[model samples]
Target: MAVEEVFYKLYNNILIETNLQNTNYDAVVLIAYPEDLNVQLPRHIGSFLEKAAKVDKHITKAVTVWNCDYVSGGRLVISPTGKVTPYHDVSVVKQAAQKGVLRALEAGAKSPLVVVQSVVHFPDAQLVAVLGVLEALYTPLQMRERVAPKNFTKIGFHAEETLDEKFERIVRNAIALERARIITRDIGGSDPERMAPGKIVEYINNSFSGENNITVKVVDDENVIAEQYPLLAAVNRAATRVDRHKARVVEIEYKPSDLSRVIETLILVGKGVTYDTGGADIKIQGKMAGMARDKCGAAAVAGFLKACSILKPPHLKVIGVLCLCRNSVGSDSYVADELLVSSSGKTVRVTNTDAEGRLAMADALFKMSETAGKELNPHIYTIATLTGHARACYGNYVAAMDNHSARATNHSNKLQLSGSRVSEGVEVSVVRHEDLAINEGKCKGDDLVQYDTGAKARNHQLAAGFLIKVGGLEEKNLKYTHLDIAGAAGEAPSEPSAVPVLSLCHLHKVFM
Candidate 1:
């Protein structure tokens, strides 16, 4: 598809309508608690709900459609968020908004006015609700090509109490986030062949062609990749022979216009395993069904860079690397028990070919670590759907493990808090001495082992340790965090969740 044709799909047709009585919209999607339906909602919506409550008892509890004349087309879609609790967070609001938008779409409403009744506990409820609505409205890349191109004509937002500037900021931030998420979802959720390494490079080149302050550099040559990123090249051994599925190193950078405004530098390396057949240690028993999503970590890196390109937040310089490769099973596939030298010069003994995501990213991460020392207050991150042990441990929540420097600064906890506010769950995992020890090579021939086949505990945490060791971050005094998104990258048969993009943006104050 042409760049212009696909560009519009990344953003929503967002419209902000402050006037509650505006009759231009086709439907009113109300998201609120049962008790606040009458109190917090507008007088017209509250009155309609009050009248409907007398006739229907389940009106306040379940998602329902009410016939009313106060709004446009006489269609009112009420999506109730269950009782808010101290334990509950903004995700409830996000989920309710998504459901409300789905219901509005089903009702044949091309334009819907969405309103959220904010809770005191969740300060970012309105923003979360808007994000959720965008999530529901997002059409997959393949669907946009073959089926419906867009979900709605326009999405309207109304806040009960807000100044014009604050409302505009909320809308702008949400749009930027959703736009970034669209890139992530497209690359993360597309079929393996559709989003092959070469195709991803093409899509990225088209997506960020003229975006200001953003630069993209791709390394596509096989010999150069083999020379510079041997570990990654090893994982790409079989696929390198095929032009379409060969490896790609996509480096994206965002720089502030005023160099004096920069206070810190952030480097992100993401594992873009377009398709993981587990190489020589091939996956069996239906385990390879959703392997296309293994690249979500890299997808998120691109999305985060997209957000940076849009917002152009000051005082920060961000660099993102998408370590793209395909771990294909063939005659030339890299097998286990092979010792390969990493970019950091550490010898890695391949213990399990299934553990390829780390190898795909290790060289880029090591290179980033080398550059982190010169940048201003730099922090490096390695994000990947690298382990099943993470899913076994956290179950659909991102697990963040910090190195010594990041742990000293309480980085993971900060991410956890920021993520919770934006409806993304982040769990903090500690990388201990044992975790590091698990990756220690069994024999004297290798410096580190690729996978800990013998030990059973902390496999996910150990993966982080392996990256730190192989990426040359160990004892480097550079702040680094490894995000294992195996469980949270997006469950099977669903669109990519674009995990941690909002969290990182929020933490860095990237939005305008």
Candidate 2:
């Protein structure tokens, strides 16, 4: 017999032994009483019987015997054929309930199963909070497809209590993150000429309009992002439709309610290269594949912003910056050995087309620092899937964090002030331009192999150095950090990871 049939048989037997009057054997109900109950049955055996009953609709009455007294309780389905699945633990129970329904549908079960786990002795407040979070999570996971498209644009709270509010916030954040992934995957590799950043900004603005206080700003002035930032423009020039396309910076800001508690503003910068083809210095074979995931860093930042909007820390402001464009092969693409000037007016000699993430980030970081200077000059954090060196160093489990020296010192001091032990050996890496090298093939007809020896060996640090150059922040004016998240952003064949998002959320909680 099948698993469901076996469950039904066991459930029916338990119901007959327990003196339950139901003969149909379509469902079973089991009661969990305190240890002092005057029952001769083994606890584990009784629990197992209850679980079996939930597998098939075989029994339907649950009577609790506490101490020497018997109390009549509400009925809980042990076996929900189609609508629900019974669970002992609320967390697992919620997951099981949904999964059981799906499984029944797949198995072509005729009846609707509804699994219910009723808490008999637990505190009402805690139970309610737990149930509320589960309900919020359930709505998005089960009904995302059923919800109208217009509902995606508005923001609403799932639960009302402040103590349990974060749970609902996190659920919404996770949903938005999933939605962003879907949007990005769907729009991937579309004609860059036809799809503009303004369109994306409009979509986001429209979809998330009323619910959360989110402001999406699209910087369309190609020169605003391009003219001085040659390194960024260099890769973009390779696109066949560069003239028809405008490089854009998309900024999403979320501000908190109170000004006094706002300890610091957090700025998240993401490398938004929608598509990357190793330009004139083209990637050969294996290297060019999966370039579509180049924008994962930007996706993470967008995800972080969505999370912030939902979480809404009382005194934290989050600014998400996405530098979006496509790097394709075209006549305007900067060839090997081209010198490009950054927004900070620092000239960078382009050595490789694939090192385009840093180029886009250079201008974005500069603009962010400039903008912050006019405001509160908040602590800034830039995250990007910028280098293979970071992957080699951290292996996708953790992002390489590079903090300004002063900020590191200050953080250590704060730890000490709080009576916490601060490790002396901990250090943050900073990349410098001197670390970068360009191999322009061979000069003239010289057969001797020319090596760019002076170029920086620490690839990750050099990338950070370039951003600092453009950010124009003095050592004293700002606390800045760069997170190289190449390995953390994508899943490997062996395992899946959401390192960047998890790390950002953790950091947000700390600073908020």
- Find the candidate with the highest TM-score and give its number: 1
lDDT digits (tens) for residues 288-363 of candidate 1: 8999999999999999998898888888999999999999989899999899998788999999999999999999
| Global lDDT of model 1 | 0.88
Ten-residue region with minimum lDDT total, candidate 1: 2-11
Model 2 lDDT tens row, 1-512: 11111111112221112222222222222222333422233223355445545663343232221111111112222322122233222223333333433333333322321222233332122222222222222222113334522211111211221324444333334343333333333223223332344444554555446645678877767665566455566567655264444466788888776767787787878786766777676778687666666766666676566556656766677788877777777777776566566666655566676777878777778778777775664777777778787777656533344445435545423322221110001123544334322332244432111123355566676667656655665343667777676765554221112235534444446312
Runs in model 2 deviating more than 4 A are 1-199, 228-230, 240-245, 406-457, 473-476, 491-499, 510-512
TM match of model 2 to true structure: 0.60
Name every residue pair that clashes in candidate 1.
Answer: none
* TM-score of each model, paired residue for residue: 0.96, 0.60
Task: Give the winner by lDDT.
Answer: 1
